[model samples]
Target: MINDIGDLLTNLLFATKKIIPVAIKQSIKDTIYALISIPKTKIYVFRLNKIISDHKKVKGYIIYPPTLDWDYMFQRPQQLARQFAKNGYLFFFCNKSYKSRGFKEVEPNIVTCGADTRKSLSAINDVIVYISWAGHINFFRKLKYTKLIYDYLDSLKVADSKGKGLFKKHIRLVANADLVLVTSDILHKKLLLEGRIKKTILVPNACDFKHFNIKKTINKNFEDINLIVNKNKPIIGYSGAFAEWFDYSLIKYCIKKRPNYEFVLLGATIGSSFHRSILDFPNVNYLGEKRYKVLPYYISCFDVAILPFKINDITRSTSPVKIFEYMASGKPVISTNLPECKKYKIILVSRGKKDFVNNIDRGLGLSRNKNYILKTQMLAKRNTWDKRFNLISKYL
Candidate 1:
């Protein structure tokens, strides 16, 4: 009778264990539904959902498209934001989509705002510097800022939706800004034509020298060197996004001419019919997007770095970060004659298929020369992000 009682108790405990979780899960679901049914909670969530800003007062630099904070490339906005934060200023990165609300601290001094932040322009304290890209002109214009800086990061008129009147908005932004920063000479001239010549300053893109300057010790310590880097043939590499501006036909031509040269393209390729043809080439290799930290290892193995970009309105104003990065890696760069590339005398500028093919040979020859490598490295050292930041500091 005691053994039967023990078995009954054991079975009852086993049943209780199984029943408890199901009951708890049901209770949670019921509670969630009950909470959602409350009108005040729904209203609170709606307001919270719309806030996408850090309501911080500490000498902020407002950057539109908060996603730039996470970009591995650390473009102009992110680079400057980090420098500003390091110098005792709180950096507030505003998301482009102002639809939902919350704020996240992505870094020690950098705060990213979500869509739901309810802080008004007046409520935000110590916001002295306001810088914005072309797209966020109207959105940030209303904010009361002491110094309005318009950073023309790109030629928005050519890049954005054609019928959205974005360029028109850009005009108003230029006129309103206390200072205007253009990335290229083409942009500088454009701003001059708009009669904001005095305010416009050409602040070209720069590189993080320490990051890309891969030392000899790094090569020895790198374990994945043999796995990812192609050591068989002379590696001609290109890093950065393969967007519409990338000259695919020139890349195809280069592969056909120099079958002995192994061309490696890195970064995510935007969907294009031309991609399949380029990948089909036996001499060509595509190693998908790599983290910024490991990029130096790949670049270290390169014989020549290239910037084969199409000559168009988009390329005209682009001061490529890759050129500086390639130089910092101490590699010779063969590039098309984009306006910005021409400024760097170290770069071998190619104008056509014949020129492109010839410069690749010239670049390959230059890469082997120790003096040439040092020259390129010197150029990069001078144009470091810190140097760029110093120039920006004068205006502030």
Candidate 2:
């Protein structure tokens, strides 16, 4: 009698001890499995659909750098890819670092592929967009596409030993590509001088105005902003990776020059000697990398934002996304005198260490310049991913 009572109670709770509908039992099993699983079994089912599902053939975009998802810092190629997906095109973003081998549909029209499927991309069709020239150039010939776009986002000169013959390879790739997009004026001029490709066009890096702008309301999710702002010191900020291109000596010089102001560096320390050593300084605050969604909140606390890049061949042709991001925050921006910075009226370009420090001081004073804010915000509004896609649609 005791065993029967215990079995009846257990069955009533689980709906498994007695006769029940197949769907109800299945739902209960699924609920139990979901509770125990890491990310839930349904997520795996959705990911598996990319490999087994019969997807319709449509216009496809295959981006080379593998960072196709929205998670990364939202670089130029990924931004454009998302825009294309929104406008009804199939997109495949390849990530060589991904542990899995198959492609998964992360969005409505966007599919992200892992390293296992790098060489097996026959499913996607149409546009092939190459962000750089260092990838396997020979394999490109095998892929059939209506258009091939080589977007020069970075200078290949700084690449490792594998990039030795890249100039010649780029010449060939440019010759083969239906359209060539250069991100900076320096790159545009260089391509023109080479005379290897005549169909090259300039499509500079742009801002996601909706995310980085000052007008956006801050909700409870932006708790980090409150913590940062509560510091109460005049904050001078830099957001992005601390790479070799970062001017460490200049940063150190500025820190010493402006001891009264708090200098904050936000982002990963990617093996840069200066970044590793600079934390020892008194006034410098090294806050590690923040997520992409919350970056605007952290940046909103900044009184003056900076782009202290070392001027070299690599940086000469660089079109930084941070300039627009900083501008969109409605904060004063002081940057190194890169060739591209000359085109923007809002940025205060510095010549050297003294100039950089002085400009930061000047920027702090001009934080409430409504005219300057309007100009930068207006410029940022015009230069967006939507506008860039409109230009790209011309060739497509």
Candidate 3:
């Protein structure tokens, strides 16, 4: 009963964005929220301690620190949690908002639960608590567990997205983590330079090959895309966030140069970084974000896939999952020379606007080459979430 009330105040501090001031640090908000619910916290701690006393015989348990809601755009947190559950660990992916949804069993071993969830569990002795967001530092003490792993997926240098205050949390998480998993070599190298490489491992992003490489024909349910894709012109496509880091200038150049090519975009305009003026062009089509299930159907329609991201510290650390999804679909991919993208030789790394546009034309021919298709698909098949889990499990 007490656990239920804590769930209301626990994730609500971060989840209910309109209620909380944007200027306040999430850690402070969460800390204050936890403090207010001391009675609830005591109950949760008692329940957890009682479970330890019982000595229940279970394999293990995995808990993800509260982040995005489970139903939101499926991302690394959800993907990795699924993998852990598949391996027999009872996994929980906590949400940051919509606590009213209650505890939802997403799969056989996996469930998405609301915050302050001591009622749901019977044990905490054999537990692994995984965290990606530095803001979750506030919950560290409250989440007493057997192991704590910090997945350093993104850089803290991107100042706009709570970087300044969270930087301190990053240091604390990295310093105290049982194991650290970095998604890219640049991140692994960063840890090395800082002399924090003792417990870090590189487990880069991967694709679900069987999911992306569709065997059956996709139904023509996407009525809106029919308006954009033309038989006369080739389709150059992109998916993922339309954020501040996206290279709008390069895409603008590509759109103007190839007037015949139809450019289709998927994903949401994150904050105010995306200017609507570019969408006004006749050839450019912004269809908004599709369900993750039907995302491949949209990708399969592309003659070429692109990652028009600004080469910055944030991108350098990012292992673009969309790039692999495009590869899995046997589509030729082009991108600005992000270190992660540049690692793959097949991905046409563009130096400047002219070269980026030129690559789109090259990609048209590359799409026809059966050998190119086979190699790209094979690369995607090789790097599955299952394989990524195998690497991570060894360290755990």
lDDT of 3 by residue, 302-396 (tens): 88999999987799888998888999999999999899998889899999988898899999999999999899999898888999999999988
Q: Pick the candidate with the highest TM-score.
A: 3
Q: What global local distance difference test value does model 1 have?
A: 0.73
Clashes by residue pair, model 2: 66-94, 66-95
lDDT of 2 by residue, 1-396 (tens): 234554555466575535777777667656555444534233444543454354455455555545333465557766877788887677767765666456677777777776665555643455566555545567566555566777777788656434566877777778888788889988898887888447777898888898899553546765645555667778899998777889988998998888888887888666544456788877787877898777887888888999999998889989988888888888888999998887886789999999999999889988878887778788888888889889887877
Candidates in order have lDDT scores of: 0.73, 0.74, 0.81
TM-score of 2: 0.81
Candidate 2 at residue 64, lDDT?
58
lDDT of 1 by residue, 13-44 (tens): 55677666767756655555555555543443
In model 3, which residue pairs have backbone atoms overlapping below 3 Å? none
Pick the winner on TM-score between candidates 2 and 3. Answer: 3
Q: Least lDDT summed over 10 consecutive residues: which range in candidate 2?
A: 38-47
Task: Give the Cα-based TM-score of candidate 1 against the true structure.
Answer: 0.79
**Candidate 1, poorest ten consecutive residues by summed lDDT:** 47-56
- Residue 114, candidate 3: Cα error in Å is 1.8
